[model samples]
Target: MNNIEFKHLILTAKYFTKYEPIIDTKTDDIYAYEALSKFEIDNNLISTEDIFRHLHHNNKLFFELEKRNKQLQFESFTENKKLFLNFDADIFVSCEQQSYWELFLNNKKDDIVVEITENGSDDETSANIMRNFSSWLNNKNIETALDDFGQDGSMFSFYMMNGSKYIKIDKSFLRQIELNYNYMHYLKGILTTIRLNGQKSIIEGIETQRDYDLVKELGCDYMQGYFFEELMIIK
Candidate 1:
C-alpha cells in the first residue's frame, strides 16, 4: 500500500487492545499482561501481522501508529500488573526517535517490559540492530524480554538473551514436543539454563490441561496462551 492508502487506513481504522494474561506457574495468579493490538475497518477485522508488514515499509508511519496504539494500551489497562509491549526491531532508526520514546515511557518504566520482536528478516545486521535497541532500553532502566525465543529464522543470540530480564519461548515448541517427546528434554535443558542465568522464562501456547501440566512440570516461571483465558478487551 502507498503512503496515502496507509494514511487513510490508519484514519479509518477502529483500534482496540486485547490483553492476554501471563499466569504465574505456581500460584496461577496473573503475573503480567501482554497488550496485543486489534484493528478493524468497516467492522471487519484486519490481520495485525499484515498491518505491521506494511508498516515496515515506512518507519515514520510505523512509529506514529505505534505511539497511538501503545498509548491506548496503557490507558485502558487499570490493573496494577506489568504490561509487556512488543517493539519490532525495524523501527529503531534514529536517536531522535529513541529520545521521544524515552520521554514517553519515563513514568511507566517500572510497570513495563519492552519485548524485542523481529517482524522481518533475521540476518546478522538485524540481530545487531536488535542488540543495540535492547541496550538502549536497558540504559533507560526499562526491562526487556527476548520474544519468540527459538522460532524458525528468528535470531537467537546469547548476548541478547543474557541481558534480557525475561525470555519468552515460542509457542511452536508445543507442537514440536507433540511430534517428538524428546523435545521436552531439550526444552527442560533450556529452561534450566535460563534459570541458571537468573532470568525468568515464559512458555507460550498452553492450550489445555495437559499442556499446562507438562510445561509447569518442566518448570517455566510463567505461562501464557488460550488455556488460562482468551484475549480480553478491558473496556
Candidate 2:
C-alpha cells in the first residue's frame, strides 16, 4: 500500500491477538493477545518497518497516527488487559516524550510497556540516539524493553546503562538451548546477569512444547511464541 493509504489503514485498524509468553508452569494462561496493526487491503499486516519509514517521511501523518494510537490505547486499557505497544526506536526518538506522557497520564503507566523491536535503525548513531531517548523514557516511569536481543553485536552495555527494564532473548537462542548444553549454559549465564542486575527476561518465538519446557526450566519470567496461538483480532 502507498504511504497515505498505509497510514489511514493503520490509524483505523483494530488489534489482533499475538502470542505472549506466560510464567513457568502456566498452561491455559500461558499466552495473551497483543495488538497487531493490519491493513484492510486483502486484510494483511503492513510491514512494520514500512510504517515507521512512512511516519519518518511524513511528519504530519506521524503525529496524527501517534495521537490516535495514544487515544485508542487509553480507551482500550480501561476495559482490556495490559498492552505491549510495539515502538520503533527511530519513531520514538523523533516524537516528543511529553506529548506521549500527557496522553497516557490518565492510564496506568506501568501497564504500558514500550517494545523496541529489532530490524529498526541499528547503527552507532541510531544506537546513541536511542540511548538518550531511553534515558528520557526512564525518567517518565515508562518501561523499556529491548526486543529481539542477541541477534547482533549491538552490545548490552547500552541497555544496562540506560536502565532498560527488560531484554527479550531472541527466539534462535531458545530454539537451540535444549540440544546445546554449552549454549544453554551460556544463556543461563546471561539470564543470571540480567537478573542480578535487576532486569526482566522475556523469551520470544517459542513454538513447541519442548521450547516451553526449556524456557520454564531456565526460569524465564515471560514468553511469547506462535505455539500458543497465532495473532487474532480482539474486536
Candidate 3:
C-alpha cells in the first residue's frame, strides 16, 4: 500500500493505543509521554523508528496522521499533565506557527513537551532550525526536549547548544549498559554533562532490573520504558 493508504489504515484501526505518563520517582512528577500504536491483526506495536521512516518518506501523509494524533492526545490528557508528543524536527520546524502553537496553548503552555526525534533532519539546516525553534519555545515558556540524545554526534551537539530543558537518552544506550562497561561510562559522562549544563536527563528503554538500577545509580532525572509501566490507552 502507498504511504497515505498505510497511514490511513493505521489511524482507522481500532487497536491503536496510547500509554500513560511515565513519572519520575525522585521528583514525583510526570516526565515523559509515550504513544504506542498497535495493529489489529496480531496486536503488534509499530516501532518509533518505523513510524518516522514512513513519515520521512511520505511527508504529506505523516502530516495528516500527526494532525489527527495530536488532536486525540489533546482530548485525552488533562491540563495539569504534560503531553509528550514525538515528531520529526523537520516537521516541527516547518509547522505553521498559528496552528501548532495554538493547539499547544489551547492545552496550556506548561502542559506540552515536543520531543523532536534525533535523526529526523540533516545536520546543518537542522541545527539552525532547532536553534530557532528552541528560542521560540523559550520565549513562550514552553518546554522542549532533545529526544534520543547520544544516538549520534549531531544530536549531542544539538542538546548542548540548543538550550533544551530536557535530554532523553536513546534506548539503545541504556539497553547495553550491563554488557558494555565503556558504553556505561560514556553514558555517565553524558548525563553528567547534561546536569552540569542545568538540563534534566531522562533514561529511556528501561525494561529490566539492571536498566532501572543503573539509571537510579546514575541519578537520572527521569525514566521511561516498559519497566516502569507499559503504555496504557487512556480511554
Candidate 4:
C-alpha cells in the first residue's frame, strides 16, 4: 500500500483494541492484559501483521497510528490491572517523537509495560533500535517485555533478555513441546534461567486444559491464551 492509500485506509478503518488477560500461575488470577489491535475496513478484518508490514514503509505514519491506538487502548481499559502495550522498535524515529511519547506516558509508567515487538525486521539495525528503545523505556520507569522471544526472525538479544522484566515465550514453544519431549526439556531450562535472572516468564498459547496443566507444571510465572479467556473487545 502506498502512503496515500495507507492513510486513506487508516482514516476509513474501524480500529479497536482487544485485550487478552495474562494470568498469574500461582493465583490463577488476571495479572495484566495485553492490548491487541484489530482493524476492519469495509466489513472485512485486516490482520495486524499485514497492517504493520505496510506501515513499516513509513515510520512517521506508523507512529501516528500507534499513538491513536494507544490512546484507544488506554481509554477503553477500565480495570486496574497493568496493561501491556506493544511498541514497535522502528517507530522511535526522532527525538521529537520520543518527547511526545515521554509526555504521553509520563503518568502511566506504573501501570504499563511496553512490549518490544520486532515484526518483519529483525536484523542488526532493528535489534540495535530495540536495544536503545528498551533502554529509554527502562529509564522512564516503564516495564518492558521481550515479545515472541523464540519466534523466527525475532532476534535474541542477551541485553534485552536480561533487562526485560518479563520475557514472553512464543506460542510455538507450546506446540513444539507437544511434538517432542525434548522441547519440553528446553522450555524447562529456559524457564529455569529466566527465574534465576529474577525475571518472570509468561508462556503464550495455552489453548487447552492439557496445555494449561503442562505449562503450569513447567512453572511459568504467567500464562496467556484461549484457555484462560478469549480476546475481549475493549469497548
C-alpha TM-scores of all predictions: 0.95, 0.76, 0.78, 0.95
Q: Candidate 2's residue-wise lDDT over 186-206, tens digit each?
A: 888878888888888878777
Which of the two, 3 or 4, has more TM-score? 4
Global lDDT scores for all candidate models: 0.85, 0.62, 0.66, 0.85
The clash count of every prediction, one per candidate, is: 0, 5, 1, 0
**Which residue pairs clash in candidate 3?**
19-232
User: For residues 1-235, what per-residue lDDT tens digits would candidate 1 score against the true structure?
Assistant: 5788887787668887778899999988899999988788667777567788777668888887787777888899988899999888666668777877888778889999999888768777777888888888888888999999988888778888988999999988988998899899999999999999999999999898989999878878999998877544444
Which is better, 2 or 4, measured by lDDT? 4
Compose the digit string of candidate 4's lDDT tens values, residues 92-207. 75898898899888878888998988856767777788889988888888889999989866687899998799999999998987888789988999999999999999999989
Residue 117 lDDT in candidate 3: 59
lDDT digits (tens) for residues 1-235 of candidate 3: 6765677675775544466566685874665566554445235556546666756756566666666666665676653556777655555555574367556555655667766555556577677766666666677677777777756454446443456778888888875766777787888888888889898888888788877777888887988877766444444
Alpha-carbon error at 36 in model 2, in Å?
3.1
Candidate 3 residue spans exceeding 4 A from truth? 2-11, 27-32, 38-51, 78-80, 93-98, 103-107, 119-123, 152-154, 159-161, 230-234
RMSD values, in order shown: 1.5, 3.7, 3.5, 1.5
Residue pairs that clash (backbone atoms under 3 angstroms), model 1: none
